[model samples]
Target: MESHIAFGYSFQAVGKGSCSTWGTGHFSTFDNYLYDFSGTCNYIFATVCDEITPDFNIQFRRGQNKKITRIIIELGPSVITVENVGIIGMRRMRTSSALKGPVKIVPPKADVGH
Candidate 1:
């Protein structure tokens, strides 16, 4: 199966742009700058790094075959890891005295019979 990401302006207040990557490492930046990068390395897709601790960070790793192997997302109090094989692993962030977690959300299953 192939994975494609479509971008949009969902959070109009927080952000106002779109960036997407699809098929063989083709990427379209937020400003509509398009490019192709087929590197097999860990890449920081997006992040707010000026603060002491960022609220969110999105990253992905490509395998030697030049395909995305996995994606790791750190969103506030949760960490989500998604593998290309369709398995998603999730966890929480440990605070000074407690832990903050996310509510479980599952993706829809693919219709393989089709």
Candidate 2:
């Protein structure tokens, strides 16, 4: 079965934090989320990072096989809060190009009548 489970309790942080100590001008973190070519948020990040760059943003790519990942961003802020705590994948990608096409189903032959 596909796992639709979103790991753990979810929370949000909207101020400076531990990572904020990193500087007044340079960092951000996002979990379980990504920015598209149009620079829009299509999904929510599973995790978050403290703001350090005065005013900036965060981006992260999830993996296909990773269930858990711990990040310690030092170049951003000194403050950080871990809500919705749980395992997360980062920057996942396809392993094979052969699996990108349509699939064919085979049918079983009818049993011979006695």
Candidate 3:
């Protein structure tokens, strides 16, 4: 499994099903439902509803131009917020053992030659 860090929490993609939206508010649900929405607001795209307490939630914020402006992901005690401003920031839920400082983002190295 490949590990990825978003908003300071490390996770891996172990599931197959996924949801997606693109092109002027077009959306494709996990269950294969397709629709179009052009609202300028924050909306929940996906969330864990199997358990009494949700494990995670994903939301997207649409700007006035009908484009995605921000993405928010809530995983456990961490809330990761990514903006179209070119910087990825993370906010951890306040706790006695919460980590301090900002999370660093390193660009992946470009592959040269085959």
Report, for every candidate in turn, its global Cα lDDT versus the true structure. Answer: 0.55, 0.24, 0.57
Off by over 4 Å in 2: 1-6, 14-52, 55-61, 66-76, 79-114
Tens-place lDDT per residue, model 1, 47-70, is: 665758765767777778766677
Candidate 3: misplaced stretches above 4 Å?
1-16, 86-88, 91-114
Could you tell me the lDDT of residue 59 within candidate 1? 76
For model 1, the superposed segments whose C-alpha errors exceed 4 Å read 1-15, 86-88, 91-114
Residue-level lDDT for 69 in candidate 1: 76
Number of clashes in every candidate structure? 0, 28, 0
lDDT of 1 at 113: 75
Q: For model 3, how does the per-residue alpha-carbon lDDT over 36-105 read when each residue is reduced to its tens digit?
A: 8889878887776664765577777778887677777766666677666442446333335323222222
Q: In candidate 3, where is summed lDDT lowest over 10 consecutive residues?
A: 100-109
Error of 2 at 49 (Å): 13
- The alpha-carbon lDDT assigned to residue 87 of candidate 1 equals 37
Sorted by lDDT (best first), the order is 3, 1, 2
